[model samples]
Target chain A: MSAQSEFDREIALDAADGEPGTYRGQLGEGWRIGGGINGGLLLALAGHALRRELGETSADGIPGHSDPMAISAYYLTPGVPGAVTVRTDTVRRGRAVSTGQASLVQEDETGREVERVRVLATYGDLAAVDGDATTTATPPQLPDPEACVSAAQAPPQFLKHATLLERLDLRLDPATTGWAVGKPSGNGVIRGWFRMADGREPDPLLLLLAVDALPPVAFELGLPGWTPTLELTAHVRCRPAPGWLRVNLTSRTLSGGYLEEDAEVWDSEGRLVALSRQLARATSPRR
Target chain B: MSAQSEFDREIALDAADGEPGTYRGQLGEGWRIGGGINGGLLLALAGHALRRELGETSADGIPGHSDPMAISAYYLTPGVPGAVTVRTDTVRRGRAVSTGQASLVQEDETGREVERVRVLATYGDLAAVDGDATTTATPPQLPDPEACVSAAQAPPQFLKHATLLERLDLRLDPATTGWAVGKPSGNGVIRGWFRMADGREPDPLLLLLAVDALPPVAFELGLPGWTPTLELTAHVRCRPAPGWLRVNLTSRTLSGGYLEEDAEVWDSEGRLVALSRQLARATSPRR
Candidate 1:
């Protein structure tokens, strides 16, 4: 619509010359959470490569199976901004759904290619997914977007390195931002509203990014520092409608030096759009 | 200790003659949900192979990284009871964790080996996992194992085909089993206690099976019939203390003919031992 949003530009892939299944992409700047790129952005990059490898049509010549229904990724190493390659492998091409695996590899300081993330995803037509539709989980109650605290208002030290916040309109619920001022709720829940700054409509692919867009829920537990995600799985339930999306992230248990964060995303129409769960290493605030 | 339990026997893998990464195993009878083997059993089989491939030691020669911390599986096809081969591939061997990929291949009716399940998992030492542990979610309230209705008391039609029930001591809370009597709770939840009939202790690998052992939560929503799992991810948080593990399954949303089932498994110590989330298709009862 407007020369492709920044998100599209960043995740764009060019066909590689040597391999049919390999594609080249660039990790754009301003997406670092700390020393590495955000995990969701890396997942979206691989999802893009997987979609390209699977093509727009299924083996049955049907126009379905074009969207990633569920994708699980394991972060092998932190990703740095630079040139990266995504290698895709088609596992199966069924009539109803198609499955593919993708790996995002980047070169290290020694010029050795290191795998940053490995993913397995299934693609399907969300529109064709018809049957009973019911929702027992409701959207988290929150004030209007304009009434919430903007990411720019976060602690300067945190906002300094998390430049990715500048690219999105992230408004945090004031109740959940207590940790920013040293008064955490201790409930391990983070609720916020997410929308791309460039006004791009969120699709299944973007939902991947939206699922992990929130700051680590551990922050709400007063356990600061970076909580690196080891593995994440996102399920795109349906296509979302345009407008700001409501996101709620919760950590039910924190045990064994690791915690599992679960996210539920609801679209403007109040319909659940995507759900995700990630396992991450828990870290305590620096003494 | 008594002899090996039925589960260990069914999931036992023998070294393949030729390849170093290949192993032979059999899908023992009784673990069938409908026409095929249970998804959890298949996952356990692959996890066993992954543990073998990654070995018991890490690259640092440390005696850790043996348990599966997180494992995700995609069900390719329904597996019948028969001989199956598990092909394992070591993706990486890090100091704290090791990653591996495995595929369970079985002979189809056409005599061609077809991949039944493809899994990507990361293994680590549960005992070595130490950190500031905190949990806000409490275990589900339910009657004692002896007070709950046993799997043997289920509808004869379902019990006849689900021989897997006989192998485990599954006692479902009466409130959530209304679908068996044509009175649906309309709230998608099922709580139960799980244990092996032979009194086998529950380990991380066994927790994989325990995660998906319960009947579909869709049953509580008046939905009947088989709910095949499309993708499942299980996270083992900590080791369990022997006895019956408390399992709670819930379906928060059923949209577009697909529903997500999230499970929280608490051990006898009341500690959260494992967490799992699965995507499955919802089916309505026959007219």
Candidate 2:
């Protein structure tokens, strides 16, 4: 058998023997952003649980409601690398789509279980979706992967405490990396190409993580502290083609200590695969 | 006491005497578009319930976590104008923010209660939010409300079955209202000025309703059938100044029988007050 990809192994969930909608998993290391695990990774964990609970064939002989069409997650606390529990609840089951909710919980130092993230998702069969395909948004222009600067090779200051960068091959658009050297573009935009280091093909589930893999857009605006996501919503439009995924993240408005970052993920086939928007706390640059 | 505005009377909720976290409210008339209630109004119902549940003073003496910062809702079934029961669950209460979930339920013709919408929201005090304010987005430009075409006086065909227009003073940009006639601009953009007919001021909760008030962006794309929103997420940034709020809605892509519409609501002071994104079914233009 082929070796399992790091992402697959990290997000793998074991269903509880007696619990119909409960699963257990582990928060693997090497995915921490500052003092906690990445928000996207945490969301992917909940998404996986929701998929497992809602992907079953309906009693009415209906099938193919496996892919997550829309998912939203609210981050309550930062996740740490440890054993975690995910409890799923089927909100509604219909012929075409089913909705489910999942909560990721972890045991704190005091032995109390604390909720890390709560997610709500709707599942449907992407293959059954057929109709008009129109787009006014195009893939962001960027140099080829080889020409872009590898995030792994970014300045030491930029790579500090971001172990998650080691697990993915992220190539940032050179133009937007000015913040690494104390020269921010002040444009509040970040574009990059993302793929698993092991070259695992992208799927609807993984797109949840891909949408938030890039650095916070506030970096380009000269604000460099860790921006914690408060809430994030992702819409998986279609299955992505195999290859590098182009990502563009932009922050349009920052008010009241919060910023809304919108991301668009495009596949190598130039198809728009997923779109996401997140609300996060905006922090000022460190002195 | 001053007379209650129609909006205030319509959205008023009565606490369930025995249920700690339950409230009942009517869906109200004149808010129907097609055969179902507007998604925004349904969301507002749920938001009101969450506010009542989470707006209490914390035991830790933390004050001002009342306004909803981010809220997401999944539309499970079409909401008809009737009595709705909202049940809220407090997910977590923190010093700075509190998260809660609410589900709107109503009885169907069969006498079985049906869940219409499920919402998850994070609440915080908008008044206490202070820090660096930065924005790359500016309010969309549009002709004065007097120069624009009032939706109430729109073409008869365009005003058909839309009683909600009579409650809100909506003036659409003349350039983008071509869709009302058979000449769509084909730009998938809608800009307008929005205000309650009774001169009610926009609040964090009302902004939820205002964000989804405009016509579907698909209409400008020459596809004019009813677009049912599958999921929607709105972030209320701050309180608005009393005046006609400018709203701009845009659709960037339509694929797999779905499209994402993003809306930005700017107050009279030109400060962005709320932002929303929704995924909806895209329908073909009726021949």
Against the native complex, each candidate's DockQ, computed on alpha carbons, is: 0.63, 0.66
Show pairs that collide, candidate 2.
Answer: none
Clashes of 1: 0
**lDDT score, candidate 2:** 0.88
> Which stretches of candidate 1 lie above 4 Å from their native place?
A1-3, A58-64, A129-132, A284-287, B1-3, B58-64, B129-132, B284-287
What lDDT tens digits, residue by residue, belong to model 2 across residues A195-238?
99988889888899998888888888878888889999999998
How many Å off is the CA of B145 in candidate 2? 0.8
User: Model 1 Cα RMSD, Å?
Assistant: 1.9
Task: Count steric clashes of candidate 2.
Answer: 0
List, residue by residue over B190-259, the lDDT tens digit for candidate 1.
9999999889999888899999888888888888878888899999998888899999999878888888
Error of 1 at B267 (Å): 0.8
Model 2 Cα lDDT, one tens digit per residue, B1-287? 12398777777899999998999988876898755898998888888889888998867776636798999999999898888899999999988799999999999999999999999999998985442358878899999999998888766765666778888999999999888887888899999999999888888888999999888888888878889898999999888888989999999788878889999999998888899999998765544
